[model samples]
Target: MLETLGRSLDSAIRKIRRLPQIDKDAINALIQDLQRALLSSDVKVELVFKMTENIKKEAMNTTLQKAKRKDFIIKLVHDELIKTLGGKKAPIRIKPGKKNIILLVGIQGSGKTTTIGKLSQFYKSKGYKVAAVTTDTYRPGAYEQLVQLTKQIGVKCYGNPKEKNAIKIGVQETKKAMNDGNELIIVDTAGRHKEEKELMKEMAVLEQKLKPNEVCLVIDGSIGQQAYNQAEVFAKTTSLGSIIVTKLDGTAKGGGALSACVAANIGIRFIGIGEKIDEFEEFEPTTFIGTILGIPDLEGLVQRVQEAEVMPDPETVKRMMRGKFTLEDLYQQLKSIKKVGKFKQILAMMGGGNIPDALKDDAEKNIEKWRVVLDSMTAEEKESPNLIKKSRKRRIAIGSGTDYAVINKMLDQFRQMKKMMKRFTQMRQKGKGGMPGMPGMGKGAEQFMKKMSKDFKF
Candidate 1:
């Protein structure tokens, strides 16, 4: 989601690596590039300046004994950015008392209601007796939208359209939920524009009556720098504990929301990537930084992927690394990868760029087609792709409900990968000589790959 910013930062870091040393001048230049990148993304000028200052100071003062200069500089920048966003993660306060109320506030089209539903699902998944209540007496469809969403999530929702008293509805709903054995009451209020004073007053009254444990402001990542202005206005009316940035799945300027949190002095609690109930992710600083830096934090991604399937055998990975990767092994790898969501995200986590715009749709179709083709192949065929001739291809196409063209494409891709692996194996056997166009391919690359190969044999 922060693709632009990520790329810009990566480029800046690459330039830093060319410098002779991490001196004051080099650090200042790096900070200047970062400032330009943040400003180009429409971040607040003051915030950008402050961030650059922090990065420059940290990079100059931090002690680096054994690490590479570039690595130290990148870590400095990452740490400073985290500090600007919020030094320590702030979690939503859930009291031990009877009913812990959480009130959500935001402008229209800010995803306030949907965030409430997502939060309710998040709590419900955590084994909390959670219920949602709509006190949005102003908007016509507000109550219905929340009601339908809560029902879809199988959570209780309290709303009365005829009642104009939002405070009374919030109080009654909280009381009823407490008596009904609900420990958490999430109040979804009507969306009000930042300029609406009357609506703000009403929201304040509801907050006063409910005495919510947490007041979260939902923001749209696509709003860019405007997210900060919205948070400022909302924070003035009520104490906002955290922010929930939604609509991160598309081409939204998500970095702006990160900047907004810094400006508003609020911690981000959750990030909504899609409309699905499971799309909400708790804010994690290190993993987020790792992703933005184009470093595959395989440990983090593997945990999420593991939730969908049993862990792949370490022996299987070792076999593949040893150049014995077969179609059977490929099938198992695909099954593990598919659990982590889309192909694009998986590739990005592997330090690859986004799928080419023209190939994005085709890539998804190819994945679906490949799954069916693999399912149709026999055990012997899967163990050895070379055994698949034209007749086998035809059989697989007919069995999988796909065309011969799809089968041919899958075989072509597999052959290309096989050729690359064969070349790698040959190079590894050729005494540690550096191969042409091979990254880290000298003795260092070979040693690293060999170590990884051995380590994967769990």
Candidate 2:
């Protein structure tokens, strides 16, 4: 969704790279490129102007050292873009051992109920006893939807389909969830704006009665320019303490929604990247801008690895780094990577670049094919891949429903991986930590490691 804007921003950086020196003409051209990108992404004209002015002022005032002028200018532009997106990240402050009442508000069709499920799962994984309360009496099946969502995430939900009062339901649910040892209670409210003025008034009264710890406005990213008006309206009704932008993975106006929130002076607490409950992520302005500017979020990738339960323990990694690994271990690692997600997505995150969807799909298919071949291997063959002779390869290929050449290809890859790991171990022992250029490590691994260490601490 933000790919178009990403390309434009990258192009602006390219303009700077082509310059022989940082001069007034080059700065103007870069600013103009930035302006066009932001405006095309539906950012407010006033906000874009202010952002470009700030960038130009800072770039012109700062004198650069000769050795790394290009890098310094790129970093300057990156920092300024982050500032336009909210300056810094503001995470939700959940109170421990007490009910953290988070009231969700937005207009209809903003994916509020689904977001509640995602939020519950996110907190649940963090060891919080989470619960959901639905006060959305205006929407049919709202209560049932929350009930099912809570069930799926193993969180208790409170709602009464017969109840007509939103405030009463909220109050009752809060007490019930609190008594049941729920540390977090997420309240889902109705978003009916049939009578705009009346709806806002009702919401204000509900806010007064509930006095939630946080009032979060869920904005649909697909709404584009209307996001600002929606957020402003909701903010006026209640204290819209934070924002969560959803449906960012689609061809939505994600750039528009994010920039609109910034212009409205609302801090974004989270963003929904996909429909899955696990696809939600906390909003960080700098990291987000970095990703859009072709800088991958290595930390975020590590987090996802942990979340997917695919990251090996420190001991396993240590052993592998020391060159003690077999085909069995290689198969296990492959399984873990498969569990992490689509190969292309992970690769993109590692490199801080985008991959074509077609290529991603093709890579996924190859991974599955390799998994089949691995499955066909015997226990001994897995532990000692050298035992797989031509006859054994044919047998395994028949079992895996693939050609003998495919099995041979898989074995070759396994051998290459072992070789690469040995090289990695040797390099580390020699105190050459980075992957750098190495025989059998391949250009892909070298490129990946280079991009990873660009901003990664370890």
How much is the lDDT of residue 227 in candidate 1? 83
Residue lDDT tens for model 1, 61-111:
654332245566676677666665665456666765466999998877778
Q: TM-score for model 1? A: 0.59
| Superposed model 1: Cα runs more than 4 Å off | 14-29, 57-67, 95-97, 193-195, 297-458
Error of 2 at 267 (Å): 1.0
Total backbone collisions for each predicted model: 0, 1
Worst 10 residues of 1 by lDDT: 342-351
Q: Write the per-residue lDDT of candidate 2 for residues 1-458, one digit (tens) a residue.
A: 47778888878887787778888888898889988998887777887898889888977775333324566567767767777777655567888997688889888888899999999998889998899999898989999988988798898889889999887888887888889999999989888956878678777877887778889999988786678899999998798898999987774367778988988899888898878888888888877887887756535533443333332444545556567767656555555554453233333333323333443443355667877888898888887889999889889888999998766766776786677567665754665534554433344454544543342423
In order, candidate lDDTs are: 0.72, 0.75
